[model samples]
Target: MQSSSFLAAILFFISAAFASDSVHKYQPDDAVDLWVNKVGPFRNPQETYNYYSLPFCHPSGDAAHKRRGLGEVLGGNELIDSQIDIKFQKPVGKTTICEIELDEAQVMQFKEAIDRDYLFEFFMDDLPLWGYVGDFHSKRKGDNQHMLFTHKSITVKYNKNHIIEVRLTQQNPKPLEVGRKLDMTYSVRWIPTNITFARRFDVYLDYPFFESQIHWFSIYNSLMMMFLAGLVSTILMRTLRNDYAKYAREDDDLETLERDASEESGWKLVHGDVFRTPFSIALLSALVGTGAQLAMLILLVILFAPVGMLYIGRGAIVTTFIVCYAFTSFISGYVSGGMYSQHGGKNWIKSMILTASLFPFMCFGIGFILNTVAIFYGSLAAIPFGTMVVVFVIWAFVSFPLALLGSVVGRNWSGAPNNPCRIKTIPRPIPEKNWYLKPSVVSIVGGLLPFGSVSIEMYFVFTSFWNYRVYYTYGFMLLIFLILLIVTVCVTIIGTYFLLNVENYHWQWTSFCSAASTSVYVFLYSIYYYCMKTTMSGFFQTSFYFGHTLMFCLGLGILCGATGYLGSNLFVRRIYRNIKCD
Candidate 1:
């Protein structure tokens, strides 16, 4: 009797596993619907696209009228085209959710599909925004490839002239188990009037990533900032007290000066030539100019992001970046020209040209290579030709002339008191340094501290970029950015003081290198992130990842390098100005 009972229980469970389908019919009162396409990882199986839905659903009513803009001339809009509708049999059962079958001619559109590793995206008001998600990995035994399926319950209806309308109810408690029937229903009393789905997407999907796990990162960065601040403060106080006493005695009398002359060591000895401009002054000036421009752009972006100025629409932030960068060209030329002239550079025109060309040349050269790869792969991520032309036009007409005008103004007021001590015609012999005091050793060690301060936050940034997730916590990001700047400047100042103590006065590049080497750490961390954190694969993904990152690092190197150099220069000037150097 016990054995019979066990057999009956097993039969009951099996019957429950294969339950019958329960279809939820489409309702007219539903506010909005998004029909999902085949879902897969960044690297999907070739057949996945062949089987996914063709270009069926598009704007039919008022939506097409509203989404039109001047940018529509660039020609990526599919909603503007006549609707190509095809009819297929009504999906039969719950098993029908497992596949979306399209014929050969219909499948040709899929052939030219952009190779985005995204799992799912839907068109809202003719703009494709990422929100939908689905299981891509095959479940069948012995099958080793990504599979496509309907993640949510979808209801289909045929309209006039082959147009098809879909009412898609989101799947609840996702990744439905193999055994049970999957049925879902979504209700809306009124339709969403927003042109883009960004707002709704942010509320539903993006908020969780930003809010969760940020507390730990915040705590870590805050502690680092406090530690660095305290360390710098202590050093500043001790150094100032000692230096003041010695300099005060020097100005008192000949007897007091003679007694303290032998004891005068470290940075005081280098005061005579501390402000003497180093070689490649023009390039250094340009770097500093460009860095300042970028720093301002970043600062404004961070401040604006929290205020929602740059967060309103698709590509708004990018547009802000481009426009701000262009307008900031004058600042770059003005600063570079002023610094160069102070350092005894004669040709103001050359300084302007160098400052204006440095950033754009590097950016466009690297960008073109990466964009070519994107285009070859049919990726929508590639910048359009028209957009590139617009960028170029902005650079040529607005930015270049502004740079020239600023340079002319900078040269007019370039006669600032740059040197604390008069430059001697003959060069002073720089004393040889110990092993730890060498340039290479100092640079490597200098960057590590700053890198540590920002390392935790960088993980989230990379995840947002590579994983196609949303990043909305600009407030936290802004705090971390401030901390990073503080840490970089402080660490560079400390390193500069030490290098000067070792009798090495060539600090222009060393100070820059000391801070800029943080980019090396960032790049290495990116490699580690790629290997461990992401599942992306393919030649295009690999090429784009490393190539684009290299440029990013280069830009950061310039920014941090300039920041560190400027801080060190300020410290050096301040210390030398108060000293009694004969």
Candidate 2:
């Protein structure tokens, strides 16, 4: 049987080569060559030809490996050309690779019947975005089968012309198939960074949102988180930037001087009372770290998928969760501390304690409840109970103390640089309002709006992650992600603007309030989402539910908080740009 299969494969390759090679060399024919042609639906005894885009699903019922019907495959909008196009850059060694485009309908009718069930699902949950995924591996066919992945490489440009070209030392190659299913497997030689997925000032609609959110979240939240430690970093910089007080008639002149002076001041803008703000450091740490963590998770998937660690199987989220947690701890410490320092906050020790403590407590507490149910159901272990204890023990005993240790050290080490943002206090006996309407409480509520928008979509995202469903909609998820980022910034901006309008601007710390405020709504939305969408059973299911599900939802909350905080801070800075600070 093996010998027969091998012989048949050889015959098929020869036949495909003879048929395609006779065709025209559309563009500089000798410059590129058609190297391979392979068919799939491997289970069907009869050989047949087929093609489909990856993230191509396995057929339902018994239709597996069945060549798509000619009428259907050929029909417009019927998903006709399901294929992974492996466009070559430079032919490696002596191998030449080129396209063999055909009416997929014609090919289906031309072949013998076969099962149509073979397929592989692509995922974005554990990975980053790929410009294009196609199936084809390369090597030198003639003389010395050397690895051709090195040196002879090309950049993959998406949304470009059909004439995808690969430059090589111009050589002819044999025909072959890299993957049996319609999946695109790119080579290491392919460089994604060099090629702009955009041209003439446009990116995939998702790119703008990604850049906006990442940049906005990183910068502005640091400013908001500083509110608790209580030094308006902008204020501190102004005092330092204009140690000799001066007034300006126009905004641009003052803005220019401040920007230049700020650079020279050498005082990092994050300090003081900002660290004391409740939940600021704790949650901001979660967002910044989670963002960074997600980035790594993406790279790990793209760089190492074939090697088998990242998206390997059922245990993938476990690895992701651990990494996420570890990273969050570091970010929490850094963001909280940096902001505290900018506020000239004296409690570095206390700030660190809160940064390391708050998030873990909430995450672990919720995670524990869900994991317990998963264990009771007799499935996978929901993070070993022992591990939970170890985690908390470290948080309380190790992290909390280090924060205290750092706080003591910072207090003894120095004092706030002799400075004065001498805002002559305008004292006003503040009028009171209904508790629900108060700026502090209301702004918090205002913050949760985006979380409300996202909860519906989030349920499916996690279920797919835990249940081992192949999620191929990453390209779309990337789009949705962009929108959410915009929505987050908008929410934060509006919320902070409303608060500044109130007399209680004293509580400016809640600028992160927009994002943090949304967390409450997120929790509530999940309650509804869970009841409406899932019918989960067993501890394995529930633990997976808690481990995978809540993390995403809550982590999403953190993302909002960070985004909102940043947005509001910038708004404040822009508005107060001309306000006197000395």
Candidate 3:
């Protein structure tokens, strides 16, 4: 009976191999070497709470089919179906392999196909989405790992037989010549895969989409980050709550006195005080802040600049930093001035400078290390030293002035604005109680959870970006998007409940504390990712990496939990600050 079963299994395997058919067979059309395509202005895409336009569609403009995306895909509900034709011809008896490539001296340029422009569409189909990142570092269908923003699970599976070549153009960062011209560059080259899959090159169009066109690695990274971030926050916040509470309210003379004198805003009531912020929370905020600035910068540039749509890839990281930091400084100065004034952190000027310079220092240091490493390795795509200098000059000369202007404008508006609620100044201290956590503390804690929920995703993200991989998976990302929104909402609700339960009588102070905890978790996970995953070196390298990383975490934390924190704070301050209870 065993021998008969084995024979049947062998027969099934033989039949299955012959029955598979996913890839078609045909040779690539002629590969163009030189094409002078005209470029055009890009328009902006609509903004929504639960959506963002794909990079290929940003700055919404017309251009050559190279240099990035000439014909950008327009609006769609999350993921829409997309396709790329792959044609290849190997000797009937032999196999051919394929790989993704991103090596050249200049950017690829091309022309747009007016209205017939269906660049690519994806149908999200219930997958959660975060965001999309396209780096030309990976050119092979297989053989490449997710570099900076990808997941660990990136193995593509399909029935192999024939082949087709899906080609596109490449060019230089427009208006900057002195480099080689990019032609109809195949997004993926079947070379390394040639070695891996016996010279078989199944082609791939490197775009992040959902539905039938999802990439496994990209999806995994997004989901993983949120999971890790949430898990870590939950453990620390739940297990270490009492410890943090004591640390915040303990009889430490220094913390008590400092909290009394140097602070004024309701922060004195926040989860203890700034110093009481768990060492882990502080660190995460610092790191996630950097990523926040980066995200904001990219979004702004894409929304404002003429060429941002086509130029928002690869070399644009520096450009993003310049613009984001400039704009962020204004926000920092304005918000800090108001919050610190409310908190009673005297010296608004000092706070402004601190906010403005904080990210700048981080950017310079990291850029320095990355630039050095690129020089040492002789990577062709390395941002040039001259370009670096130019970028610095641009930031200082162009962006700095703009930031200064915005700060002044913000300061004026802050003063001019009417307080929605009247301020009452008097010695009204709350009676001692263990029920309600402080509002500042609550918000901060709440912020930390969202951060934790997303940290696990970073493991794959950093690896994808560092190792140089193409993370094109819209389906999984769409799923992630939904999950992220739901999880964020759930975590916020859970945190708020725990806080209200602890101090049902003092819901105000405890409200904000819950949200701020997520930021704390984000910082903790970053440390974990750094210590356990990344091989980055040097103080500058580590500091800069941490700084920008925190920026993203911080932004996400705030954006996700803003409604709860502010609403709770207003309720508390209005109802309790000057309540007529005698």
Candidate 4:
């Protein structure tokens, strides 16, 4: 009975979520809801505030608000019901909404909003419409006047019973004055259209920009780079094979053996120290584990988004990401635990804790700072206290426990040390090499190719996020992602081989950093993009833009770092496997 009740509850929850998003068929004279969403400056996309934050006329009594999902709240949406009475297929002529007695305070507010170029957003039957608050004009030299729009004209187009489009036009501009009596009025017109509801969002998609020749050319260039990276890897493998044959030849005379030993001063000389536990093994393991989880999470989201039409919903992407991250916490713990154990680490508790909280705590710290900024500015971007608590509960109860369970399972299953070479009792002293051969240099240079491979795609992704463009090309994104991974692995492998060739055994962190440095270049490019492409000004929008970009870079860094390390590990083991180790 308890199990049955639980299943029923789950089903009801799912149904409720889907039901709110389902299309509605309206009968003639049935009331349609107009939802007032948010208002913000035209230049700043993320800096939004509640619709009622401005001195707009409110409903006489208590107003109804729409309940939003987890994603919607995170995306900074607060939808309030606009009590404009309208019926389906019923056209209403100019009707007075309210009389706003403009006092000094209201005049000041209107002037400020006009100066900032604020725009209001409304939703009717799930279709969105936008209109500016007011405009400013110069009647003569040194004589400027601020005008407020007092009339709203809404045109709704429908096919049969389904609303297909909604448009808003602001009219009746009245000069702002201290004792002005401005009448707020609205008119609604219902028109029949042959367009279907499914094709309504097509108007918002910029197909020419997304599918241009430049975009396809970029993809082709990335593909060519991938093949080049593959060629480099194949060459490295062949060279390693030749070394293996020479080192494994037992019939060589003592004189020949001695000559060969004298000549072999590169990677072959460091076999004994190659498998030694790296410095800060626990932190490295945790980061790698987190990266693995992010890699899988991004792949899953990209695959699921197009298939499910996740773009149609307001906050569906964020909601899906949070839920998927929770479920995939197991992957983080599993990878961290196995890596820690394999490296002979004894602090199981520390490893588990770090694996679970590292990335999340970093994000939370950044979010806390950004949220404070939002709150100070009275922006709707500030996450509410209740939403924060809900996220915490989900992480604590669901993500943490799953991580713990995965750690235990991983420790028992794949924690055995299986290095191809044994660690020496004492570490070999790393000889100084040329400045160009240094780990720092190699790490920096290693990321160049990988960054180049995905640089074009990054521009598209950034524009879509910050410039109000819908990104529907997950297929292009997936291909670019795969190319990035391949290039990162191939480049890091080459870097690791060079480090080892210099008789350095600290290839682990070096390899990771080599690939992870791609994020540094990406962050720098974001700075350039911000300066050149966007006209956003003010502290709030600036902080949010760079803060979010930092978060993205951190995740990308971790993902690439982990992939590099894993690839290098395979390469190191393969090359050493056939060679005789002392």
The global C-alpha lDDT for each of the candidates, from Candidate 1 onward, is 0.64, 0.41, 0.38, 0.89
Which is the leading candidate under TM-score?
Answer: 4
Q: What TM-scores do the predictions have?
A: 0.75, 0.44, 0.42, 0.94
Q: Which tens-of-lDDT digit does each residue in 1-582 have in candidate 3?
A: 999999999997765444322112222341212122111111111111111121122212332232221112111122222222222321111222121223232112211111111122111111111222222233467542222121111112222332222232222222212342222111333321222332222132233421222245445654665676567557744644554354445335556746665333332233222112122222222223323344355445435443342222333444454546655644444443444344434454554555455556655666466556534533222355555566567667755555454445555565342333333343234444343354455556555444544454455455444433333332343455455544554455545444433433344234334554555676777787778765555443454456556665555444444334444444334323332211
lDDT of 4 by residue, 1-582 (tens): 999999999998775443332445676777788999999998899999988887788877988988899999999988888899988889999999899888999899889988998988888776678999999777968777999999999998888877788899999999999998999999999999999877887877799999999889879889988888899989988888777777667324556777777565678789889999999998999999999999999999999999987877789999999999999999999998999999999998899999999999999999999999999999999999999999999999998888888788888898999998888898888988899999999999988889989999888999999987889999999999999999999999999998998999899999999999999999999999999999999999999999999999999999999999999998899888877776
The per-residue C-alpha lDDT of model 1 at residue 111 equals 31
- How many backbone overlaps does candidate 2 show? 54
Better of 1 and 3 by TM-score: 1
Residue-wise lDDT of candidate 2 within 252-334, one digit each (tens)?
Answer: 48667676753432112212221233345433533443333333344444344334433323234344444444543444454
Q: What ranking emerges by lDDT with the best candidate at the front?
A: 4, 1, 2, 3
**Runs off by more than 4 Å, candidate 4:** 1-22, 249-255, 259-262
Is candidate 1 or 2 superior in lDDT? 1
Task: State the displacement of the C-alpha of residue 280, model 2, in Å, after optimal TM-score superposition.
Answer: 8.7
Flag regions of model 3 displaced more than 4 Å.
1-313, 316-330, 340-346, 369-385, 416-464, 471-582
Backbone clashes in model 1, listed as residue pairs: 42-117
Worst 10 residues of 3 by lDDT: 41-50
